[model samples]
Target: MSGATGAAPSDNPQDGERGELSIPSRRPRRLRTTPAMRNFTAETDLNPRSFVLPMFVADGIAEPKPISSLPGVVQHTTDSLLRAVEEALAAGVGSIDLFGVPQEQTKDALGSAGIDPHGVLNRALADVRQRFGDDIVLMADTCLDEFTDHGHCGVLGQDRYGNQIVDNDATLTQYADMAVAQARAGAHVVSPSGMMDGQVRVIREALDAAGYADVSIMAYSAKYASAFYGPFREAVGSSLVGDRKTYQQDPRNRRESLLETELDVAEGADFVMVKPAMPYLDVLREVAAASPVPVAAYQVSGEYAMISAAAANGWIDGDAAILESLTSIRRAGADIVLTYWATHAAKLLRQGR
Candidate 1:
């Protein structure tokens, strides 16, 4: 018989000798034994305000066009874009990052449409600002790839060897102009994702000179040239022949991200972002730790498409995966997460699933 009158005898001789084989004093599973306990003990939490939805608005489209690579995402027409923004706002999404897909005929060597006040992107920005009236943050993509025929982020030039190269200085000029235009169109923030040198400083000066000193700059400081951007090319209808290895950071370098982050901060960036969040969470965590300004992580289109595709095939739980992915990003020290799943994830968070 055991010490307690009602207890049964030990099964093992060792248990009888050692007073029922001394139990562990520490049991980590105690905290995880119940849902409420797990929730209460969670180290990181997700909130709708921490999410930013990336939306693509296409010119010359009467209806929204589905992006084949990105299952639930679409290139929105002006009307549909506004409706989507409304839905996102209703879901408590904090911001919308707008990318413009101009008509193919409008693309040019200099990507002039990017800086045009009457461009599709500027028009959409104006419409959204007028409708929402600062109820939501309006962020515009300050890159030229969507408006350039070559689908490069900057203007192309020939070197002495006749090799085509992206002119970094020339692209800075265009980025400055586009920043002013976006600010004029009522963009609350302009995100420069081109990864050009001196871009943030030039845009800041231009914005101040153009009397848009109030507009914020979100720098893609640690953006890497990654395979994760494959689906985004389809979403934006890119016509690229080569890569952006010269401008975008190399994926192998960890120290380079800190250099980029420091440069952006020194150059007047209000926020800094790391691209392809999951793959670069290590970089993101380091950047977030070092950056004085807020840090954002982009859960790029490829990340979205992979989980979405797997979920559609019944290989994984879509809802749980989305939450877990976003939570991981948050845990990695991102203050804001830019994702296509923002609205859906926000709804799930509200439902406490």
Candidate 2:
């Protein structure tokens, strides 16, 4: 019988041993029912377009040499690099940041080879530009660490107390030349990753003066001095005996990133980046929110190495972890992610996995 209020009557105890259940009126699980639904509801635009593959091209290598530290990644010869680029393009990765591994014999204190037109990096840039034209966004690593025998980002000098230090002012001159050379070789973007102060202004002025006014600058605005760069050191064959704590940001500082980012943007950086993305997602988030231009994060070599090793040991699902890592970075607000797994992840995304 209905009451005066006309509400439904409660269930009789005779219907079941358990009386009545209280169901939630606001169930959030409605959106979690299917993979299609989840994908449709995804907040972040995680796709192939978000990745920027970082590739290494070595000088004087007859064959592609595998990097033991970075599993499944190789230092490609010019021919192998083209093939790799083709594969990346086929997989829907449209951008690549190139790093050149020069021969040890070419190393010099001033890293003058980095500015030479025939240097390994410039040669690869020219070749890729010629082969692909505007089919891809070619980025060059505009730093001297790889070319300098001392393994510092800049030329070394002594402080008043005779303590060896990076010559920040001298390095800017080198960076200006390096940026122009990369631009001449047809790099669409030149990334100044040495963490030198005023680098963005110097490079911008140089690029404009050289008539490559359209070339973009991707400044490493919040690069940290993390120990996680060990694998990258091996990949680039760095010859440093000490650390780069002097230039790179300290891991302990969070607000420091905003300061660095503000300066880069003010100095005309087209894009600013945070290195070793996973460990510094907080910093990435802050920079992304504050920056006027697009922000990028690097999924550095050590991050890749640890994940690959754990996956190889059957500790985790490699494919899922890769996507999750990238997704996490995207969620943290990075517009572009520089990863070693760009091509592989692109393929997986196409497969809808």
Candidate 3:
């Protein structure tokens, strides 16, 4: 029966002599086949209006001082700050985040200058508001790190062991006062970047009681104690003697971001932000999904400087990298992006290049 053979094999016509057909059915590149198609089908869009530029204003400077670590960024005098704002407006960027560089003499235990009506930040806010005339969204950085002598985000006190610890509750009072001062100075939004517990709620109450119910609060919901912030310390002349590990989140933790975001949302934050965006895209996505308000991501100084440094060395194409990084942040669910490249990016976006 085996020798009889059950059947005869026949050559298939489709295979021909090569035993293969050259039809390509799985063409993923069809979606990207043309520039028009690519542009039309882009999942995320980056625009100048969605960007907020962070600016530094020093108290007594007659001229803008360049920050060496953050190339193209500067600590501006009040006049220079106004000029920068004008440039930002012309570029179609409608928002600016202001950080004040106070004189070293004014720093103290309670950061009392933070609440002073005549303080650096307060004065700068007034100047910007008056100069811009409500055309721009003026945001004030509501944190004590720049104002405190000890350079902790909160008030410092001695523990039982006599080691210095941040006095969180006491600091909340100072934050509330600062919030009021910023609002009085005409800030459209007061951003609490201190990562202190109950800060949003405290600031909200203070603003409302002071008849500043219109002012918004942006909370730094998940700020990690990352080494990436080194350039930022230099930009603001931060006097921090020790790491913020005791207060800021550990870089190793992922779930903590959600917890912090949830707390900020419940505490009356008008918006929640993920700082140092490049390193925490997962956290940004999770927080964005859970937030009822808008989500913002800060492409910090280190992120900008690194890219610029690499671009300068010809290691990467700066233009492509900048757009790609910003697009990634937007795709990850950030409605707003704060970056040192805001003005340049805005100009590029406007030119349709």
Candidate 4:
């Protein structure tokens, strides 16, 4: 039993090795002993290309003004927006999502300026496209909320008794017009964040009919009505007097997001997205798992504001937290993430993670 009677050398690869067994006491730590090893073994990697920067371009500001709620983020003028695009491209960010700030006087009940070719957003898109010349992906946010006087995602309606409600059919027509306008303005992708039913199909057909078949559609399929958008309303100068509860899904419902994603896919959406990425990683993961096209998640303004506020107060390391948060989003199965920290994150990523 001690010597000659011991089990014979096995034919298995492990047993046939001629050298002495070199198993380390600490197990898998051996593989992670060096930076090169750790990097090589990493299961998921995040890069600047995965991050999409969301920018707000105001109509009249000459100097970039910092958003009070979102530290380090700014409302840029058209000239500054182009400069920002150049900075983002230099930092390795490949995609940019644009939002425009309309003057208070321009916002109206119907948000008619949203589809106007000469409106703030449309004009800004044309300027950016002309300057960039397709070097980067220019994405337009196709939602009426920023342009609407009431701050609702769509045009509002009234019941027989004069109570306010969203007219789904009426909104779809508006979204279709908005989509075509954005496409014609040279947006590589038109992201419909209105959450209206059949919005994807309507916008897709509208773009195709208008000879913009080359433009892509990024649908905000599972955008939930969340309180995290507090800072965003301010950034866009929303004049909302009430909540969007009637049109937006309740936070209590999770399964509804899947249904929304399913409907969006069926409507020919090229990409499906879940908004407010941090708190809804489960929804993001679910959508990413089930979606046939690329899945994106939006790290909305509220998410950015809270983190920035905390970091500014000396509560946390800002740079570290930003990278970690973005990495977590990518790890949650989002192929692309629309984030306010995109340029900063890209700079950090390009500097070797």
Write candidate 4's Cα lDDT for 161-246 as tens digits: 99888888899999999999998999999999988889999999999999998999999998888999999987888888888888
Query: Using lDDT as the measure, what is the rank order of every candidate, best first?
Result: 1, 2, 3, 4
Model 2, span 1-353: residue lDDT tens: 44589967754323334656666667677888898988788798677777899999999899999999999999989999999988988898869999999999999999988999999999999999999988889999999999999999998998999999999999999999999999999999999999999999999999999999999999999999998899999888898889999999999999999999999999999999999899999999999899889999999999999999999999999999999999999999999999999999999999878
lDDT of 4: 0.89
| Ten-residue region with minimum lDDT total, candidate 2 | 10-19
lDDT of each: 0.94, 0.93, 0.90, 0.89
How many pairs collide in each candidate, listed in order?
0, 0, 0, 0
TM-score, cand. 1 vs. native: 0.94
Q: Tens-digit lDDT track for model 3 on 1-353?
A: 12257645542224546667666677667789888988888888988889999999987688999999888899999889999999999998969999988889999878887889899999999999998878999999999999888888999887789997997889899999999999999999999998888999999999999999999999999999887888889877788897888889999998999999889889899999998899999999988888899999999988998999999899999988998899999999999999999899998888775
Q: Candidate 3 has what TM-score?
A: 0.93
Off by over 4 Å in 4: 1-26, 160-162
Residue 256 lDDT in model 4? 95
Off by over 4 Å in 3: 1-18, 22-26
RMSD of 4: 6.8
- Stretches of candidate 2 off by over 4 Å are 1-21
